[model samples]
Target: MKKQITFSIFITMLLLTACQERTTQQIIKLTNPSDFDRVDEPIVLARNIFTIKDIPNKNCIVLDKDQRAIPFQLDDLDEDGQWDEMFLLVDLKKKEQIDIIVMWTDQMSNKQFRQRANVRFANKAGDKILNDVNRLRSTDTKLSQAEFQMEGPAWENDVVAFRNYFDARNGIDIYGKRTKEMILHKVGINGQNYHQLDDWGMDILKVGTSLGAGAIAISSGDTLYRVDLPETSTYHLLVNGPLRSVFDLKHHNFKIGDHQLNINHRISIWGGAACYKSSVTIDGLQGNDALVTGIVNLHSDTYIEEKADQYLILATHDIQAEDQAALGMALLAKSKDVIDVSEAPKEGSGIVSTYLLKLKAENNKPTNFYFYAGWATQDKGYTDKSYFMKRLKKDAMRWSRPIIIK
Candidate 1:
């Protein structure tokens, strides 16, 4: 009877210890007030203390001071093939604090937790005739094709969308939306039976020779040169998420002037944001060479703002598409890396304004930058050019000052 009693006491102590281990909590604080709804902001747990498996079966809850559950999603932002971060989509008032409790008993079924960001790559399988190097086409029947028939890859979030020409010439492009619903569903193939305004969000802006909306280039003396990755280039969808979408495109042995360059490109878009992030890794670059990425100058009137070592904001409000709506586009980078902000005028496409950033590669690591677009017709506040520029500056500052996590 004594042995039985001792065994019972040991089992009870073990149960208490396990319970204590499961109720671990971590607190995150935002120093400044969030200007927009904090969507998919990651709270990465310490890998030493917690493994991916430790995240309870969808039972994680971000709680307020009063211990109420807030909607959140757990995802792998780094795309390491394992879930590692917990994303919180909260509207905390300025200077408010929040608590994230793992292993909580509350299993709240919030639809926000299931929000998705997607990317699609339609492959050409059975085409018998090989098109020319300049031929623009895509195998996917749901994608939009420009007048040039630029068939590449396309991706979108709820608010904004983007696509890259599959051919070897132009840079990345943007698609603006007025509604929060997925617009790719309504954008029919070859611009055939589709709605640009009421449904498709319209490819309102033209890329035309200029960096349509954040296409990359190389600054060679007085010329801004762009390389077109062949349609046969490898593309991979890294992350398709409840909060973020990420993909990579790699081109091997592409000639840029006299040098053959290998490039790795990765693009990511988060929920509730107008801007998408692009990082480019170039294998071959000589000394005194710089990478140029910028917004296209479709309009003659343009405004450039610079903040020493922090950021540079470029804005243009001009007549876009058939409608004369104000369209604002900006490219932001660390001012310290900026070599110069200049314009390269092509005879066929007029003037293309660009930001030149110093490209320093020692061991094949990529140089990073950001590009964004805003259409007045899509959102109310975006009609004002000043408002769009201010939004860019605010976003740059917020990114530089990340939330404090402990």
Candidate 2:
């Protein structure tokens, strides 16, 4: 009788241990250390912060102070089976602290949330459409550009959308939206006309070899070289979020004065914003290399420049949009990173007719910048120069000083 009783006790303890392992909870404290209110601030948490086996594989549940479920995503940044990081968009007042309850479980949740941002990389695969990164990076630039939807990879948030020429030109373009609906996946393909005004919006910007938007390059001396037509390239959709989406592009064998380097650009877009964050990293980097990005200047010679709160705002408001309407574009960056702000030669062999931003970079270090596009038809407030500047400043502050997470 005593032996049977001990066996029962041992079984009960084993079951209890299994149950505890099946479900685990963690408390994450996030503080808005800035004086300004943090509205929809993006936060990233690496999986290395916790023990790998402690969190279950499939489900991640996050709760707020009131036990309200918050929308979040687990991302496998390296395309490995295990998730490497967590993404969440948080809101808090100045100096406010919010405690987040995170629970990992073996069970999945059926909870659904409104999607605010998206990523689309569609290519023709016979009768099927797929995001085959290799298909768009072929040597046949012109043919592939026509075959791919939106001429390349396109991503969007609620009100703003942007596309890249997966071809050798390697430029960025914008699609201004009337409604907050995610519509790029539907409109850009299947013989549809996006150049004209639709209920959603139209392709409002024209890109002509000029960086077009916030496209990047490398600068040596006074000449610039495009990070295009590489020997190999790949596109990865890192995270597709209900509040934010992240996509990455890899360029291998880009030549700069006979020195080859691999470059990676990871861009993230968030909800309710007309701008996107671009982070660029280079392999085989040298400290002397200058990273460059810019806005097209063919239609506007006069640009409004501002230095505010540790950032430089290089912007242009003009009647230069494709629809002949006023559009405002701005590039925001840290003042310290920018070494030169000048114009590429109006008629040159390299990237010309663009206002250039030459940035300081060290070996293998990442350089980041945010690009903004505001169309008058989409937001009449953008027609006013003052309102455009104010919007850029607010966003700059929010991105530069994100909420502190402990």
Candidate 3:
């Protein structure tokens, strides 16, 4: 009787233990699997209270030159119940904690938020969010400039993981400088020093030797070319003047010695004016004089300046044949039939001649409009007389439709 009772009890206990183990496995499988601890993996002590003590006095943190931070949006980041990664945004203008973005590991996680600390920035002028790694690395060496350490996952924290994430997000590896496509902050080399380039020429680069970006420059006899770089990257190098001709003035692919630097540019003009109607006081009507003034209507004025054999080519494009003829006749005091006789392209996509028209004012009265129109070089000359006539004509047609600036 004793043996039977003991055996029965043992069997029941074993069955219950088995049931409990199965239940635990089901819960683990259902709740979340990524949180499972792998063999020999070190457990991360989750960060509970993350705080930024100090922020820079400056109103902005310029990345390269552009400001990246807007008002922080906490809701923008996804979050989970258990502690995960988060972002702390410090608004420099308000001089307070702007937002906390809780990033989550799972799909259905909720985030929490808190207000700014009672301790403000006035007494904490030099105090800033110190970076742990930077402090450790530069323990003996003092920084030349005020170094506010930025704390977060470094770019190379997990090279494989980061590469995956970065490639997923931006779809390119900018640091590597290759892939299907890319975007880079470019600086051109001139001799020993590297200068930042604008559309027209070189400017002081933001990343000099001081920033560890290295000294980049265009050397003597070395023409700055962008072709050696990738297919669709932005070049910070500009084409400086006093030239052996503007080779790739506004072109993408061209050769410059051993290297080929592709060119992309943003072209703009200023201080030019326009006259809408035809009248006397029109300069450079026929004579070889460099400066010419012309009135479109009885009142509107336009000026032209000659550069070498070519008048400064202002704006040139294509327009409709009929409309252009009407405008040419109206502006030039020529017959509409004569205007129609002008050799323009077919009814569609005909070229319209344009010039740089400048208008300035002294006090309140409207000053005269100065303008220019002609070819740049004989090699770069207009293919037809009609192209020049359209611009030269004072009554050149302008569409009444609204031109959208932006």
Candidate 4:
């Protein structure tokens, strides 16, 4: 009887060990073709398949081949206040297949690099200057010079930085980076003092009257116009992340010609990318007007490449900066929506090369596109136009074909 009892105990211990092994083996596979390491971009996995409920409880983990935990975050992509998606910021080698395990753990490891996205609105009470009864401007004038002054909110990630005007002209601007990490803090370091750069990077690009980098406009007949942010244009920071940052710029009633259009814009930026995604929704459109987005052609030395009906790329690499630096700017958009491309030259403001796309309002949904920039002095690769074009094509392909999540 003692021998039989000991045999039963041993069998029970063996079964428990098997169960633990099975739990640790739960994993998902990621397939990539390039040898280049994909940085802070989110690799989204389906939540329902994994049966994940609470991601922040230290219950979920991504394990590597050695069973070590990889840092990741869960995102509420729909903004319903409920976490539904899983994002892992990792580097996958060229032509490598990686297995990511989702298992229960008591301890979660902190991410080493700055894998998150950040945005700051100039909403401080003291930072506002009353331009008019309906308009408020930023007191910080880091970009202010003899004739040009800018006041608005700024955002950045590990790869790139962007800003939009908060006052009369709601134009978008780009901040070029020399470093791969965060550098927006170096801008306006002291109170009311705007420092363009620290030791890491500086604002190398310029935004004058032309779509300034990726500013949106309304195209009617032969003219392109922009709507100013009124008192009712409420600004909200949506997602502040270690992977993605999103914000909403809403205009309750913006006047475009005779119609008062309600516009909502959600801007998102990911890590390890030079471009930020801009999604805009304009209500009260008659479906006849065209939406125009463009890059500034300050020196008239701009090159455009349009691929049949797939994409339109507008690029400029010229000496158009305060330091006479060669800055490369480009706008990429869908070909079906593009109707025409034109050049609008302003006497003192600079030349605005615009891409016109058909504005189709479907149940008041949002329309989206991407705009990005590169500086020659910031990086050696950007000095070659071919390299910039190749990078753009790679990004476009990646955007088209997202990671397949099982």
Candidate 5:
């Protein structure tokens, strides 16, 4: 009886231990490791309820499909208060693109947390990531500015391409040297220069250039872009993908033929197609009142003139509170100077239509100004030309020039 009783106690203890071990296993959780096939799985992260998958042959982990939101803590790596939820491991699969959805709890009172992000996948095949890097480098000129110290296969292309890659990857746009003309070389299949064909683009194309200005052009495919370097530097960015859309930090992109001065960063100049042939003159300071002065000459082969006509100018200085009211009025009243409008003279003779502007002063220091001149007809809007004539008269009005009647 004693032996049987002892054996029964031992058996009960063993069962109890086994039950406790199973309970412990249930409580422990494992983080899902990223792997090849399911690199972009819909991540349902919340407080609880998630499963993991292991691909030993491939050596990866994948999250099982769970639409249910599981709570997870956001690890603020940057410490800026913005939380980073989860990072997905991506690999080339499907079209090398995968869409992922993150069901997160929203901090708002709505009591919901749901979000989604599309993470792209790269091929395990031939230098997939490296090739992407090269594609971006081919268009950016700034990347070439860096003196590459790391040794490797000498990059055959220009440094702009490499710089573009770095900037694009870092969410910045790299600009190349800005010039009025760009020359493109086309090589034939036989490794000979194909300069004979006119459409082949072996010849240089002349694009208009504005003074102290910059511009950006996006390709039709939206896969690549060309950014004119800041006036401060002679560079341009031929950027691939989305990095081509960033704006220049220094110069403003002007769209109108005329503008005004203000502490505001962006100023719009408005006019019509008549502004095209119109000559423009900008008079502004370089450091004090206005950091820049520019004109947006709209040139087009078609007469549609339907595109938005506006000039965007940026100001560098901050204006005082008292000055803000007057400045705002000046901007609205087109108090900023522009060139005068005049008719083109008979073909041969040099009948120059001159426009003049005066520099007014506030504290004995001359205030900045500008002038613009152009030729356009009544059909294109701006028939009266009253504004142009009035501004010209005001600018050239005779001041205190003392003279004796002879």
Candidate 6:
């Protein structure tokens, strides 16, 4: 009689434990329809994509085919207290389909993943102690003269990093990394020594007066004006996480010729990616006004221009880096959006050492493109021009064809 009672109590306790640990899961199906392999391609899903109702924000996770927990981010985009989207970087072979399990529960799991992407911005507002802030404005100073750390905000993944000038230059620069560790967080914290080669990496690009890496401009007829003159310039930090990081540069009351407009430039970078994505949104356009972005052409005499299956690529490779090494820079856009690539003068009232890419501009629409940087020291494979270009071509193809998720 005693043994029977003990066994019955143990069975009831096990049943209660199973119920408490129950997880609601949904099978997510994704297919790669393209012929090329999609490697670590980022997929963002909405909150309501799953059929599960009243999903809790905590204890949410993703599992692969082997039932291994994958690194994923359930981001709260607007920070209104509710989770917004799920961010994941997945791999899929051509025409291959896989099922990913997404599980969530109201209880806690106490799980933490490794961080690979970073978005950092700091300024010396009162005490010059490098206070981190989400928003900042420019005062129209010279290049790299702004009090902001590293001149402005910088974003980085494990592969590469980039920073923009908060001053009048409105220029962008690159930091080719030698290691895969996150370096930007502790870089300026000690002191501004990124120019010199460290154990992690060094600043590789000399921006000068050019468009730097891939800065925006206004091209009207034979004239070009950099996006430096704004009545007010504000910077907003949106996401800083393990898999993705995004920020925005808002130029309020930007006068492009006679058209006064506001420009919002959003830039995002993903983990293990050597490039960053830019989306420019502008309103109030009239007449023949156009938008443009370009690469610095001071050091590279020749550039390769290719029209791929889905996009146009304009690239340059030469001893253009600050370290005097080979650095490959490419700017790509959809085939329908790119009009042509033009060579700007070596010197002018506008800017210098830049080859302009005239882009199709529409009122209240965003212009999108990806800028890639490859330094030889950062990756020895980048020393080969063909390898560098081929890698970018493959990336362009992957960007054109995304994995369809159901």
Candidate No. with top lDDT: 2
* Whole-model lDDT, model 1: 0.59
Candidate 1 — worst ten consecutive residues by lDDT sum?
125-134
State in Å the error of residue 131, model 4.
20
**Which is the winner by TM-score between candidate 4 and candidate 5?**
4
- For candidate 6, the C-alpha RMSD (Å) to the true structure equals 6.0
Against the true structure, candidate 3 reaches a TM-score of: 0.15
Sorted by TM-score (best first), the order is 6, 2, 4, 1, 5, 3
Please provide, for model 3 over 72-120, each residue's C-alpha lDDT reduced to its tens digit, 9 standing for 90 to 100.
1121111343323212222122112122222111122111222211111
> What RMSD does each model have against the real structure?
8.5, 7.4, 28.1, 8.1, 24.4, 6.0
Residues 210-304, candidate 2: write the lDDT tens digits.
89889999987655888777788777787787878888888988877768888888998988778998999888765477889999988998888
For model 5, where is the 10-residue window of minimal lDDT? 323-332
Better of 1 and 6 by lDDT: 6
| Candidate 6 pairs with clashing backbones | 297-353
* C-alpha lDDT of all candidate models, in order: 0.59, 0.80, 0.19, 0.61, 0.21, 0.79
Error of 4 at 110 (Å): 5.7
lDDT of 5 by residue, 1-406 (tens): 5754654464334335434422111122223232222222222223133222221111111221322213222323233554333322222232233222222111111222222210111222212222212222222434432322111011111111101122222111111111211111112222433223222212111112212111111111112112222122111111111111111112223222233221111111111100101111223323222222222122211111011112111211111112121000001012333222212112222211111111222222322322223222111121234443432333222111111111
What's the TM-score of each model vs. the native? 0.75, 0.88, 0.15, 0.78, 0.19, 0.89
Pick the winner on lDDT between candidates 1 and 3: 1
Query: Least accurate stretch of 10 residues (summed lDDT) in model 4?
Result: 130-139
lDDT of 4 by residue, 1-406 (tens): 5754654464334335535532333578887655454554468775676653454454454667765546676777676876677767766665667887776544332324355577765433324422212333432334322113235667787767777766556667777666666655445543433335445555555555556777777655554567564337656776666777777777777666666677777788877667887788877775466666777665645566646225656666666544456666776666555666666764543234433333434337777788877767577777677787777776665665455554
For every model in order, what is the number of clashing pairs? 2, 0, 35, 6, 41, 1
Best by TM-score: 6
> Which ten-residue region of model 3 has the weakest summed lDDT?
159-168
What TM-score does structure 2 among the candidates reach?
Answer: 0.88
Order the numbered candidates by lDDT, best leading.
2, 6, 4, 1, 5, 3
